[model samples]
Target: MSLLFYSCNSQKKAQKKEAETHKVIQKKYADLLNVSTTEIKNVRLYAFIEEWTGTPYKYGGLSKSGIDCSGFCNVLYNQVYQKELPRTTKDIAKQLDKVKQSRLEEGDLVLFNIEGKKNAHVGVYLQNNMFVHASTSKGVIISSLENPYYKKAYNKGGKV
Candidate 1:
């Protein structure tokens, strides 16, 4: 009886800790995305973003120390959605069905044409016009679609 009681107590404690961690993660990402905590679903996605946030950007790089836009998206899609993505931005764009910016949903791809190049950049859509990417200057960061730079460079949203 004592063993069973202890097991139940330990299980409860573990569950409580997990719930607390989920709340913390939701709060953190909600603040980043400028939304309420309740809107921040997909705890795994946010947790993954939090873990990789601030990683340095490197051309053709694919590790935590350095990652590029497509690489970041690749890692994100693979880990979060269990989906495999093409290695390059252009290739990834090729494989996706184009989605309008206003129609984008969570886990959709946001393609960009920076500097007048087609499909030159990519990011993973979160919500409320916010997407996460490894920017050339900012490394891993969350950015808004409404930003002037992205606005002009915006190509289209994409989905698998």
Candidate 2:
């Protein structure tokens, strides 16, 4: 009887620890994204972003040391949503259903036309017009779609 009681207590403690950890993660991302903790519905997604944040940008690199826009999006999608995406931004864009910027939702793909080339850049939309991407200059960072450069280069939103 004592052993059974101890086992139950241990299980309860484990669950409590897990819940606390989840709250911490949610609070961290809520602050980073400038949203309320309740607005962060996907803890796994935020955790993944936190893990890869600040990774260096590389043209075709795929590892932690360096990753490109498409590579980052692909890794994110595959891990978070269990969806496999094409390697190139153009190819990934081709597979998506076009969506207007105003209709974008969480997990949507944001394509950009840089330097007059269509679909030259890509990012994973998070929420509140914020998206995560591997920028050529800033590496992996979260950016707002309202930024002047992104606004001008915005091509279209893509939904899988």
Candidate 3:
């Protein structure tokens, strides 16, 4: 059977205005089989995860010049994702649903307790078990979920 080939601009426009970014259809795989429309909204979220790379880390500030952990995620929500989020790490954590580690997705929010407390640090998830945040010691960067420091101090995550 032959399926109709369709490309949509309206779909792209609404998606661009939402929390997630792009929907990727692999030509390599789609050539072999039919590709569904909402293939992976979860995957689309990962696109914005790398947006803050190289942004400087700051305290009580939010911008490319510098960004705190929660500020970094906040800026991402306001600008790139065109969504609004709470300001502080504590508030942001409270705004999201507490989910299991096994259910984590690309756009899911990841919280860490760098000081062994609760809701002290936050990050936005990237692809392949990676996330981006403004490090207190370093600038904004991507890191692995299994990173020793984050792994031990992890709190909980939720959808932004």
Candidate 4:
């Protein structure tokens, strides 16, 4: 009986800690994205992206100081999903099961043809069609997959 009571108590404490952590994560991401926490459906993804927000884009760079679209995608997958992904946009695309644009979900990889080449750019899909990527012209930023620019370059969404 004592062991049962202790286990139940420990479980409750763990649940409380998780709830608090989630609340804090939501608040941080909501403030960073200028939206309500309710708007964020994937707390892990949002928080991860928030950490790298505003970092400069650099070719062949991998750290916060500078990172390219593919590098960002690679790190995000490894850190958030605990999966290893290819380091280049093209190779990363190959690792994914192709998903239609209309069927995309959070954690999907959105591939693009920004340089008139397939899979030239990549970003991680967030809720409401938004994706985070490191852009050569804009550094790290969140953009809508529906934006005219992205729509024009949009290739497909990928899920590993």
TM-score, one value per model: 0.92, 0.89, 0.68, 0.79
2 against 3, candidate with superior lDDT? 2
Q: Which candidate, 1 or 3, has the higher TM-score?
A: 1
Please give, for residues 12-112, the per-residue lDDT of candidate 4 as tens digits: 99999978888888887676556788977777776788689899999998999999999998899889899888999888888889988888887899999
Report how far off residue 148 is in candidate 2 (Å): 0.6
Q: Model 1 over residues 115-155: C-alpha lDDT tens digits?
A: 87999999999998999999999899999999999999999
| Residue 44 error, candidate 3, Å | 8.6
For candidate 3, write residues 15-129 as lDDT tens digits. 7765333433333222222334443344333344445567778898887788899898887777667888999988998889877877876567899887667889999864456
| Residue 63 alpha-carbon offset, candidate 1, angstroms | 1.3
How well does candidate 3 match the true structure, expressed as C-alpha RMSD?
8.6
C-alpha lDDT score of every prediction, in listed order: 0.93, 0.93, 0.71, 0.86
Question: Which consecutive 10 residues in model 4 have the weakest lDDT in total?
Answer: 27-36
lDDT of 2 by residue, 11-93 (tens): 99999997897899899878877899999998889888989999999999998999999999999999999999999999988
- State the displacement of the C-alpha of residue 132, model 3, in Å, after optimal TM-score superposition: 0.9
- Supply the TM-score for candidate 1: 0.92
Q: Which one wins by TM-score: 2 or 3?
A: 2
How many clashes show up per model? 0, 0, 0, 0
